[model samples]
Target chain A: MTPSALLCQFRLIGLCRKWCSSRAFTCQAAVNQLRREQGATALAGRVDRFGGITVDLADVGLPKDISETAFADLLTDSLGRWKSEGKVAVWLRVPIAMSRCAGAAAARGFTFHHAQERHAVLSLWMGAGESKLPGFATHQIGVAGAVVDESNGKVLVVQDKNKTKNAWKFPGGLSDPGENIVTAVREVLEETGIRSEFRSLLSIRQQHNHPGAFGMSDIYVICRLRPLSYDIHFCTRECERCEWLSLAELARTADTTPITSRVARLLLHGLERGFESIDLAMEELPAVYSGMFYQLYHRQIPSS
Target chain B: MTPSALLCQFRLIGLCRKWCSSRAFTCQAAVNQLRREQGATALAGRVDRFGGITVDLADVGLPKDISETAFADLLTDSLGRWKSEGKVAVWLRVPIAMSRCAGAAAARGFTFHHAQERHAVLSLWMGAGESKLPGFATHQIGVAGAVVDESNGKVLVVQDKNKTKNAWKFPGGLSDPGENIVTAVREVLEETGIRSEFRSLLSIRQQHNHPGAFGMSDIYVICRLRPLSYDIHFCTRECERCEWLSLAELARTADTTPITSRVARLLLHGLERGFESIDLAMEELPAVYSGMFYQLYHRQIPSS
Candidate 1:
């Protein structure tokens, strides 16, 4: 029979089984009590796939003062059976409060895999071909700008050395440590020699597969900038060319990327209906936004 | 048998049944041909105790140009039997991309409830209680400060009028519209008359069951501040009293509430080791934090 017909038949049978099994389960409770007189093997603590068992120790806070011998004995007794049964892997997650047990974990061949504020994950492989992975994921935080000179009908644009010929957009670069309010301003100055005032934060963008930055999640913040000087002193190393382009020229240019074009359009729309800029370095969000953007789009602000 | 023992027995039975059903499902694929000869009724879909049938229409993007007669006929055919069957509630989630067919939804007696950026939720009720609810869930975003006088080994604090007799911790209040960087600064000034400089964000706390804020999730961003001046201008309307207390005093005070005490401790800890502050308004998170946090605590941050 066809897959669709088979699926329908399976659904019908499954529905019947669902009700019948639930009833049967309730009725056979007494029968189960009798069956329990004969020894039955107990099931493992978790779901398994590809010959791996997951044991959650999140709630089971092992006694802090337990001896290393006691802990090692417990691990061997619990997991040795599974290993002998040919289980290839085991996964354990421990809460951050119990981080003191890392020494105990290391004794059992378990190694730290990754961590967050509240918890840490560790993995053990019984049948491994030499595990050689980093203990933690790497990440990079960055800031970019969409410097706008709406009054002069111009916007700061840059052509990356690596991008297509004559492709120009906003000037921004990676944020350095302690570069709070001046990150975007500094980038704009370095890229196009324009001493710009960081007007408002436009959006934040994430690139998980950033080519050059492997094993790193690249975070980019796009900001709205107000330019103070128009003198062009472009960086030769990073950009092939940089200039201020009018909205008309930007819309008409074939070299402008879609992202830049869209940003321009959004800025044009925002300027028509002014902008209520969020002060990134200073402003705290109000207690009650009776009717505002936060609720409308969830708290995730738009970004690059 | 005892509850614990009974539970263990059930687990064994469940494991055996899992293998049996999976094997049975595969074997039955070959034997269900005879059942096809018998006429089968189509499945309406899920049944619930509350007499509600949830039919997700997110994938079924109705044509924008579909006629009113056609649209009404379609909805009637789909939901009329459900109504006659006495189903009292229906939920429909329409994605933002498919919002053009809102007219048809409204025509069919659907009302908007809550919304996120990607989608909007709407529900229809034929039950006893009159449904006077917004089509989307409402949320509030707030900012607070954990202002520190690190050099002096003290922190700004206040005793809220609603809290216990002498509970004093950090001075902060609900954020207001356009009250960005100056939120904590403004709050500190208003609460303790300390013109503080906003430094870094310590953490974001969420309270789903905030008193008086019914059906609202209160999101508060706790910030770190550098106090420039120390004067006490307590807001008598909101705060009973305000003061600057040493870290030792804060740690010693038993009257301080758990949240305030925790915040104080965290701020104290952060002083020894500075916080890695992310400016949410100007930062984009990488997409790769998946599986790092959600499963670690089943998706909710640890909050008191």
Candidate 2:
């Protein structure tokens, strides 16, 4: 036997011994029986909506000691059975522990679909000419806070240090995973040292093939925020210039990006009239999933 | 040697034989020399802004025949060198071919960060506190289209067959990867058989802990559309009811979702005034990346 297989057998024996300290012979017999059963059983999987099978290797409990050749044999058998059953697609999720088997699966025509922290999912279309499966998240969310000091009709803006043009824009960055719009306040503080609170979501810009987002689409959300602190301790590494500029001047400035200038004009209108004239207020409501909630941004409903 | 390792060596010998058919002795010598050089070379990597080293194993070119023990030894030496150099974090990217090395890296404190089609990225923090490395995309974008017939002051709506509440909502679904807002028009037609054209992006809702999105966040975008075909051949599998409801009644009725009611009120305001009063117009701008463009949606700038 290979060293890895021997190591795995030893580990299993150790586990069994711990479970049944008084009966060593019985424990060894049980381990042998379990190995036999494992070899005989087929890879467990569930049929998806499209008559496809999804096999999560973590749930399959791959034997740690199995050689690559052994894995290939098992996969070959599984594929043969699945083909006979007329499955259209096969999704195999391989955990890190069983990554050695990836090459075996790949050789059998499995291509990567997507991956997460714990595992990678590979797919194969059995019936079709080409796979019709949709790709995973292709857009990145960027949240920017337009920190407005309503008292003076001024809005906080910054120019990036790394840019050639250094055009003025709202302080923001890519939203962290699982972050809410309110997290824009933290980004504003980090970039401009201006403490702020999220007031309302103002605008959303959807763009395709954003270079900064690893060639993926980008969704830029601009939220109106009320400033809590008005200090200019800007981040030297991120921004070359930071200021609270007048709304009118910013609206007409050629030094700013088109979106920034457009937003500035919108803020000017809000300052002149009530914010209710343009604001898309956010409301938290229970999501379809029990115990989960979602924020809905829309025009404020007039209280009767 | 294991069967897999011997197979890998044979493959290399085969490749070398094809490259140099004239000299068998020279080809064997070159292969042996290459293997010796590979064993001595350290894994190559680059430093990030946070003083972290990122090693892409694809670039490292791990030998196909290398054993897990050899990988573990190489990782141990590299970790000791990095720790001595005062590196804060280590980002290791292992391609599918080299996934067998993942367990070796994980044994030395590495954990999964994110992964893509080609490879999986694992990270380890050697810093004083926790790792500041951000996570990958955590939000799914759902696009909905509200097809409005201006002549009749009516909007197309649907009540999902699967939903218990059967509340009226805009006809739409999850936006496909790399899809633009214009794709919402197609979703409207698929869910309800009314053809429509994209008009303007009305509102965006950002929510967290969405159940349908694999426990990730969700961003729901609502776009106003102009209907081309008035006939409603609603999808029986998706919707129980579909109709062109009067905008005024939709704004007042409790039969619809809160967002639908709120948007209906906004539409009413737009109908009374001009669409310019509420519409967030889209403008395509040249992105920072050359030859690429992005769409920016915001309140229309008055033409001077």
Candidate 3:
């Protein structure tokens, strides 16, 4: 595929001398350069493109009353017009969901190629050369806190026991069965004895089937929090130590994980912007508990 | 770094001889096996962790009456307590905005290590051993369309002219400054002549300082559209040819780009979900234009 473009062009141009003699016109940029230099030659000749007209029959709604015979007949009628238009190859892709379309295609000359779990690939070659079909390689809300000592410019992380990879991360885990605010407060409290007030929603990270998440898609929402207490008691189940790290100290050895480090960088940016806050106020709980999160935490906001 | 954990653990247990001689404990699971076998040996050693604290002073509201000397004194006092607690390192990360804090840190023994555009790293080592601080490696939105011939399970892409790589992509460029609806329609019109109606938002892609984007942060908002006409006359400035490809055809050869294929897969998933639509009539737009966008470029609908 890398050489397909220039090779296809060179075969049309009939100037594959450099290509055949030295096998040196390998680089794509160089091939494009040669194509540019020989623009006149390219203009003089018609492109010998891999000739094909693929009829994709997946998800398309066919006439509800059209018989399979009529579908085959319609395709047969189109083949003549396609040949008139100088298309020498025909590729018909039949989606797994469209068994009727696959039947109609099989009634014509199209043959089976390969398939993914989602869709099946089929092809009908009207030309003499080979056509390579595309290969199919297919491969939660997570919330964490950027619990900063806004008074002292320190971020809190717990020393993790999970094989000492970076050994530390922002202590909060995925949101439990509660609102983001409640989860933030509960996680921060559970992991570190420090009490924190949620300030605003900070950042959202999306991962699609990431291995770190056991091949699950998850969204991680990082919230900004203001610390209220000083003493920290580490969660014995998850971490070995609890640390209050400076933004600079975290940046120096911030290899605990990429997402955490990314969150740290953003936290610094927020400090630079003077920490503009997002408000969350309404909650059904008592003021002592509900007052902890940002003003917008308890209510849903409209999408922009 | 992958094997460093097990190697470091082995060093603590005086099992370096067996590890180095055998060279068999290579996989992570194997190392975990060794750890399980020598669980008691692991328990016998006291864990040694590099200890440090960083003071971030950027956005934190320092008392208006306190002088830099008092802040320095506070940090110095913490140093003695940290040392008494067996902490061997002290780190102070000063944000670029916190110049005054950097001055106070300089008054102490904190030396500059490295810096990112947003923050500076500085550290003080009180330990008996070497302290290696972590350096900073710092590293946008884009919108693209997954134009599907829903009846035929085909996707539409244009052969790009810029390079040989991923020559095909859904006919799209960056959106202009107007509403995403306007940008979607306009960019689509400019690239391909097929008139389409904006259905709803498909995906939001954020490209931050990407090389293709001239190192600017941008958000790419993709919108799904229903094609009204079939003929496509490609824009000469950007692409060479316009094509309608089936999912199987794309799967067989859809190497236009990773993101494009990802969108295609998502589009297939969307089709499986019967292509659920997102509403947008409530946007702050004149009823005439927004109405036209949704209603075949000619009509209006009563909003629910």
Candidate 4:
């Protein structure tokens, strides 16, 4: 069947599932449960399968009018509208006086299998409210890297000429244009000639404006690597030299320019963790958003 | 009223309206008649009351596939499980994948409203897929600009010490730290001594390693201005001289530079459009992303 026809059929089946799955009492009980979970934490937690923490916005002492569940609904509703057609959308709630828009979102049709009882109550704070530093436009491409062949808690490093003060650092660069970020991880292996496989992204450092003779050098995504082949040889002209050093001894080595304290700390932690996936969460999100989680889940708009 | 109670009330009112406004009809004939009266195109073209455009994915040659919609459901379900307090909801269907994502968007959700009706189909194409480029994290803090005085179809321009080797240009500079963008806009006004107000973002231009320049410079939301006052005063530090040139004379001016081509073209079109509100859509977006129209609306994961 044509792709369109298949979709139509699938939507039909999904509608049936939604219909069959719900009972009024169960939905109502679910709403009550959501109410009990309300708190002042922010709701900007990652929506991954593994449980992530939701901050209580009120905990931060921001506007505390909205219930956590209600705030969740607002965000969820916005997402529904934004990502429907591959289009990215974002919503800003500003004071009516400052903003030209006075009207609230129009009600779209939604099929509710279950009614969510809770709502968000946070009021829009005025005068330089929360910063959505990362707008919706930045596309996040997944990337992975590794630290290889550790002998006595030491991994690998390379000295480079281009960076500030010609410091020793991990041998990696950005993913090429149209290159899969994951694939780029492997390229590090090909260039360095040291057999290394993928590891989790250890930390992300955004250097808005790097301090040096230069202005802004851009942010770097640091990764942890594991060794696949031991003996190392420089296969590319990108770096000057390579070596593996223990964290304790590495600090004394000036091969790498003085890494940021944060980077240094992460490196130490990675050594302790011994290569594991690390979850990165925005620690700054307010908690009232957490209270709004329920509304985000169950509110449905009409199907076009 | 309690925040949850407010939401419950809104939902209740919506439910009553649904039941009272339309009688339930199960027959295919009734569905067909409704479709005919509304016309699929008309129905599809309805502007989302909340925000954004809604297009039937089926109408646009895209469909919701079984695997993708099911996956979408999984996301909602996953979000619900992670939050525990409230479910993550989204506006379903209102397919927007074929368009650019911008403006007011919340989340992406897909659902099938009826079993008998065609199941919505989602066609998943391979690869990283096209995504919108993120603007600067700093730029999102809002922009400030001036609306210059009525120039009678003539706008003020300055010959720059750097680029003036060829053309006339708007007088402005990078925003300083701790100052709001609007403050920067006002600063430009004081330095230039020309009254103006912000109109809209004109465009974002990033030229890497241009013929003469070494680094990238971002363009700003162009402001329109009234001649609060005018002076022939030259800021010897940056500008050589200020002049108000008519659009007709801009091309013939000996001092016009290569970059002036873009400025001229923009001015010509903007002037033709009566210079009402700057066409932010045209300015802020690349030509490639302009064609897309619809987006995903709202999605909900039933609290199971």
Best by lDDT: 2
Q: What is the C-alpha RMSD of each candidate to the true structure, in Å?
A: 22.6, 8.1, 27.5, 24.4
CA shift of B81, model 2, Å: 4.8
- Ten contiguous residues minimizing lDDT sum, candidate 2 chain A: A19-28
State in Å the error of residue A191, model 1: 1.7
Number of backbone clashes in candidate 1: 18
TM-score of 3: 0.28
* lDDT digits (tens) for residues B103-210 of candidate 3: 455556665543322444455677775754432111112345656778988877777766556466777665322223335666676788877776655443322333
Writing each residue's lDDT as its tens digit, candidate 4 over A1-304 gives 5565455445544444345333323443453444444432223332212121222232322232232234345445433433442322232322211110111221122111110011111112111345312211111122334464556666666666444565656666554323333343565675567766554434432232323201222323455566777677765456767777566556556555433223444455545563331311111111121221110001111122
Q: What's the TM-score of chain B for every model shown?
A: 0.48, 0.79, 0.44, 0.38
**DockQ score for model 2:** 0.30
Weakest lDDT window of 10 consecutive positions for candidate 1 chain B: B293-302
* Docking quality tier of model 1: incorrect
Better of 1 and 4 by TM-score: 1
TM-score pick, better of 3 and 4: 3
Retained true contacts (fraction), each candidate: 0.00, 0.44, 0.00, 0.00
Shift of residue B161 alpha carbon in model 3, Å:
1.3
i-RMS, each model, one decimal: 23.4, 9.0, 27.2, 25.6
- TM-score to native of every candidate shown: 0.31, 0.79, 0.28, 0.24
Which residue pairs collide in model 2, if any?
Answer: none
